[model samples]
Target: MTKHMDLPEIIPIFPLPGALLLPRARLPLHLFEPRYLAMLDDALKTPERLIGMVQPNRMPGRNGGTGLHTIGCVGRVTQFSETEDGRYMITLTGLSRFRVVEEVEGFSPYRRAKVSWTGFERDKGPSETDDGFSRDKFMNLLSRYFTAQELQTDWESLKEADDELLINSLSMLLGFEPEDKQALLEAPSLSTRRETLVTLIEYSMRGGDGEDIMQ
Candidate 1:
């Protein structure tokens, strides 16, 4: 178990678009790029073995570089293996979501940032339970959304997952836009994240043009 104090103030960040890592969820990544490979190497040397996963903002930064979203989740490398071709396959188990304080100037090829974990102290605690979750209604919406997107899944498995697992997994795995995923990541609570997930699916079903497709 990772205590709140176990998390570091400065950590490496991977600015991947459309990739979301929620607390208590696992994210698998394949690292082949030179910079990312270096990032993995450095992370392995740390005691926490953690890396921050953030989505790159669509807008450009003041320095004319790609800007990262303000919020991101930190993941610890729980599983890792090196490939014959020098690539690395790793699985990150999410620990907490953090707000970026500022990007640090560093000699590493990858980016690093100073982060604050004040508001997200709960992330290090036990998994959350959403009392307001309507399993049947949520599943119905998910079925329609999956059908429209032609996505296949094990319904039984999804049903077996707890509230936080189900919602967070869908938020991470669903083919929502980067912005939509960011919204889910920044949601303050489980119920709020579930609501945002439903809305995004509803908007997508409407072709994102404000049409009444439910009729």
Candidate 2:
């Protein structure tokens, strides 16, 4: 037997550079920019307060526009509060991955996309059975990398965190190159993402250089 998630159309999007929000992790966005402030307004009026969080390839183009990476995660706006001047404070909970079908033109100042997410499936967070040598090895590499970066961490919680939390946690903590982080975000499976991150952390530990680490 199989099940499917109910996907919502008219998904709002926020294209950010160097921003990668993985499934099962929380992304807090402070909507101060005028364009984004308008975006929040539209999302609030809709029943599904969800937005696709995508990263741009480079700097906002000379025209203040940027090229988006093909893949992204759609997040649901779980918390929202507004400021007197109109800024929005919100926390987006990760939902599932989406592939851009094409960019949608918006009347608002910010860019929007008519994203295609029908094929994407959100993993059911991971189960207890997902832990093993592969996971521990990855964590070990992460620990060493943390030491090299002089980052203080909670080993107890990391050790005890389930697969989904651990993966997202490592993603947020490790020194992943932008392209590499994008790759991890695009990776299809948890185990694959684990291996990819382990490889990157190992390379970073070896020389802290911004080199492609995944082999």
Candidate 3:
């Protein structure tokens, strides 16, 4: 995929409430909805292969195309293929985070946003590792969380994973509510995200609802 010197002013967004894409992270999406299929078709034809992954303001409204959160990550369509069932399976490699400047007028079936990359300029840098992160604490909390949720995993693979992979992959895979996922996505730094994840895991283990962390 080609690197972007800067984010585009107008871009199409895929408003998936619980789905998020962080810089340098890869997000896999299955496009079945007609509107999104059209969006993917357009993206496939473009050289940039860009798509903004955003969350809707509400759950039920997501299917009806509601207002979106201001912050989102831009991803490039790195891998794509069409299924016999007419669905488009694509993997997006995240590029940068962008804040919506305004909505643009468009006739396309998909939504478009005028965005600014001023706030997330740091995304172009290298990925964060476990240098100063509390990896041990994080892992302990993760173990508790998995047991609490009754989720099974391959311990060997998980332990062998790097800091970035472990943090980002679990952040996306965990059963956090949309808002909680958004908090992680919009975190200012990797360290901040790690702290937030630890806090949420602790709350869940204490018989408190995980979603209540934001409240």
Q: In lDDT terms, which candidate is top?
A: 1
Runs in model 1 deviating more than 4 A are 61-66, 209-215
Off by over 4 Å in 2: 1-5, 59-66, 83-86, 122-133, 208-215
List model 2 lDDT by residue over 1-215, tens digit each. 01234656556778876567876677888899988887788877876676788877664552234377778887778898888997888988776788776776757777777667665554424332244446556666666677778899888998898786787767755666678888888877777777677777777766757665333
TM-score of 2: 0.82
Give each model's whole-structure lDDT.
0.90, 0.71, 0.81
Instruction: Give each model's clash number.
Output: 0, 1, 0
Model 3: per-residue Cα lDDT over 83-163, one tens digit each? 999998899998898887777778899998888888787787777775777666667767777887899998888788888
lDDT of 1 by residue, 1-215 (tens): 56554788999999999999999999999999999999999999988999999989887773235398889999999999999999999999999999888889979999999999889988889999999988998888788888989999999999999999999999999988899999999999999999898888889998879874432
Q: Against the correct fold, how does model 1 do in TM-score?
A: 0.93
What range of 10 consecutive residues in model 1 has the weakest lDDT sum?
57-66
**Which of 2 and 3 is the better model by TM-score?**
3
* Cα lDDT, model 2, residue 47: 65
